[model samples]
Target chain A: MSFDITAVVNIMGLAAVAVFAISGALDAARQKMDILGFMLIGTATGIGGGTLRDVLLGNVPVFWIREPVWILICLVASAVTYFIAPKLASRSRTLIWMDAVGLALFAVVGTEIALEFGTSSLIAICMGVMTATFGGIARDVLCGSNLTLMNEELYITTALAGSVVYLLLNSFNLPNSYDLIGGFLVAFILRALAIQFHLKLPNPHRKD
Target chain B: MSFDITAVVNIMGLAAVAVFAISGALDAARQKMDILGFMLIGTATGIGGGTLRDVLLGNVPVFWIREPVWILICLVASAVTYFIAPKLASRSRTLIWMDAVGLALFAVVGTEIALEFGTSSLIAICMGVMTATFGGIARDVLCGSNLTLMNEELYITTALAGSVVYLLLNSFNLPNSYDLIGGFLVAFILRALAIQFHLKLPNPHRKD
Candidate 1:
């Protein structure tokens, strides 16, 4: 049976935007930001990474400006998150899972886009990781929180691994569907494990 | 005598990039980051604002990617600043002035580019301010410093005023050179006065 891989990527991309928006709203709630701040930060988190990737790759008008459906997803997701965040007993847990899914989807989609743009594998891999992580970094920065990059957690490493996996699978001429799913699963499982086991990289500054 | 307005804008833009790179290197020094960190942050600060503006306006390949000279300027300025920062007795003073010059220049140049792109006046003005201010904001975020946006300072206000000035001059059919210079003077002088007088906008959170 033939399947449209592009269709699946687009759908998953929207899901990624929604989850990122929810994560951003949760961050805004942590900061006790106003409604306007919530919307702005949430939208930024949803679109920031993809926008940066498209721009660097010279894709004009950026993704949100072209389709705008991406922006609508961000707004709706953020507003819903704002209302439900207070009622959730385990907000942090929800945030972690949401972020992991977003990271995995964005990493694979971004790498695919860069490859389609005819960029080198190295650049494509880097763009994938950037697309996965930069949105959260922008959210933390706007919230004036400590940078997630400065943390010793295996956060960026997971994205990097996923991008590499996707590139490897593509090189092996695997079905595009399998490559996408394999990349996403590797990233999500790795990140979930990191969160579950509190896995961290070695910090030179930390005395053992 | 007919003057090439584009040439002048291009040259001054380089100057602006140089000053911004210096400021970023100084910030890296304050954080005691490694040499690689110095170069990375310096390049980001030097080109960050313009890159965002170009991407948003759909000016593909970005200014630096098309003309690698911009990146070269950033590297040289950053390395020079990294070396001289230790000997300066009042590094903060140098930083402030360098930042002011860069802001003024970037604001006018950015506004001109947006207008050339046929954007609405309001959008052009916003892009101008974004081009002037986003680099410093990114620098502060990367350094994990208290966001300058959180301060009640007139920093963003000055860039706004400069953008407005450029737009007003263009509307009045002034010479292109005069419009650029007029905007720069207004922004720089206003910022200088604010610095000298400790002028600040009223804070809503502050009790008299």
Candidate 2:
């Protein structure tokens, strides 16, 4: 609603950038891309969501363009991950957990931004989901991973739920911290459960 | 510099959308993508550049959002291509020529937009290149094509040259028509030459 909440979102956003950057860097390494590829994919994944959200919300110059610290962070995080991927290869689960946290945070952040821009709840929720998931989607597209692999994933739904929960709590005029933390917990727990149980949306159209 | 020029660019831009949409649809067909894929890729290709330009220039809601006729055109063009690609499989070169025209027009249009936004000539030139090439890049990324393969192509350079030529002519305060037509010709001729002679940027990293 104000500068205080925006500041909170900015602080939490850094963790999202780090995990997303790492994920992008690892994908580049698997494809035998050079440093250029590492940086390109990493930056794209880290900022792609927010960029899309900002553009749709009519926010010019975008957040990263305005401050540039986010860009620097993505570049550094991705570069560092490129060097550490082999060592962290066996610890991939740690990366996954971090990714979940990023996803949860992005959902709330994106929705908050859209609402601040005076958009309707529906559009705000869409932005939230896009903000949370577009990074991974772009990463997959760039890496040429199995494109349909996400068709049955609950990832996008989790983001939507997270955003909805945040808005719901905020509508009750709850403290910003309560809404933020509750939304984060809602998203994180749901995603963790999905990951733990290997939960998937059913697809009758699937040949298998 | 004025409404007259903007009108001409808008007219030419439709052609760009059609060709770009067809290209996207063809790629989707090759990938065995569904109708949704065809539409998604087609729209992305048709409007991707202008949307990027608008976002950067603080032009909110974008041209398409302002007048969705362009979106309809892209969708219709893509659908038509989906139905006709099999019949036109051997005559794809016609499609290539149309693509060149679109590329040329996009370069000038993008440059014009940047200049209108009060950007420096250098930035305007970059926008031109982005407008001309980003659609195809998005298509390629979606299709999982080899991204670096374009590095050895003259595509982006052609866009850059075309844009610079437009800005140079505009600086002289030439008749707007002259600059627009000249820029289009410059881009089209260069691209046509490249395509005809199988010209490519030298790959210093090439093994062969």
Candidate 3:
């Protein structure tokens, strides 16, 4: 019951890239940034995590370096968002839900890539969490906001949950589709519920 | 003529950490940030480049993980700057000079580290530029300014010059101290001269 990890990774990567690009455009729109700013944010969000991963892996000709389509996608996404954002401004809730989907997909894909490179489970999980959250962190920083690092958010936790689930399923030689679906479902559900219920982890520095 | 790359690297790293911490503190003082903000900015500036390098290298425990002193140094530096900054506020030129020193030191150190890790010469030069500039980029993002990346200053060019010089010296099997001194001198001299002459690179998009 071996899985073709590469194919699944590619699909997940493309999905994550598109979702993050849109998210970046939305963030820029919220900040009232100019068109160039929006495009920059979108490109950064789309390629930032993959670039980090490739650099760590010592993979030359980083992802976007080889395939320029990712840049085109982000540019188009930013342009489209700029013109259509007014109509979609009221759909922040929907965008949040889609972002959860993207987060889950990216976490699993990142973990798989790390595992493919022979990283330990702990390192894989770290990679997964990094891949899932770094784009958002970059967007927040660029937009002049303190990242979720200082806050009690379930962001990394959700990614960790997906990573763990994916690892466990793969350990038992589960079907590839099952592993992907199962991992994404767990993360997406947890994230959606957390946002819906306003669930947040208790800050360690806060008085109980 | 063999060289002790490790020793030179260590000195450059320490110098980078110190100068960047000071720069961060000065920036925080300019913004009148609170103590926590000062410490955060200082520590980020001090360790941010190394952290990025480590993440890219897939190095475990990152640079600051083993060294608690770096954090202490940044904290102390921030405290010192907070108290002394008001008196030094009139000397903005001095602060800028210190930042240039930090940039030179970081560029040399980062290039050496990347070369030691077996990266190509081009990659090493990129690393040097990243190491020298990333801290300021992070600071600017946090401070809600776009001046760092958008400016046509000699910042990145100086770092690139230092890195290329270091690589060439190493290729010639020169002494480690010679390369270090040479690299730092090149960067510092170029940067200082640029500032003194008010020289700037032509913006690619600017009309003549």
Better of 1 and 3 by DockQ: 1
Residue-level lDDT tens digits of model 3 in B1-208: 7667677666656766777887777788778898878888877887787677666655547767878876777788777777787776677787778778878888888888777877677667766877887777777766767636435357767887888887888888886777877888999999999889966654322344
Predicted candidate 3 versus true structure: per-residue lDDT over A131-186, tens digit per residue: 88887787777767677544534788889999999888878887766776788789
Leading candidate by DockQ: 1
Model 2 ranges off by over 4 Å = A1-8, A147-153, A201-208, B1-51, B60-133, B141-144, B148-208
DockQ of structure 2? 0.18
Query: lDDT per residue, candidate 1, A114-188, as tens digits?
Result: 888877776677679779878887888788776555352477778878899999999999877888889889998
Mind giving the per-residue lDDT tens digits that candidate 2 earns over B43-93?
Answer: 898888888877876777788999999899999988887777787567788
The candidate 1 chain A region of ten consecutive residues with least summed lDDT is A199-208
Is model 3 an incorrect, acceptable, medium or high docking prediction? incorrect
lDDT of 1 by residue, B66-183 (tens): 6668877987888777667776427678767877888888888889899999999999899999899888777887878766754625788888889999999999997778888899
Off by over 4 Å in 3: A1-47, A50-108, A114-133, A136-140, A143-208, B1-16, B64-69, B147-149, B205-208
Off by over 4 Å in 1: A34-36, A89-91, A206-208, B1-43, B46-50, B56-58, B63-137, B146-208
Superposition error at B155 for model 1 (Å): 15
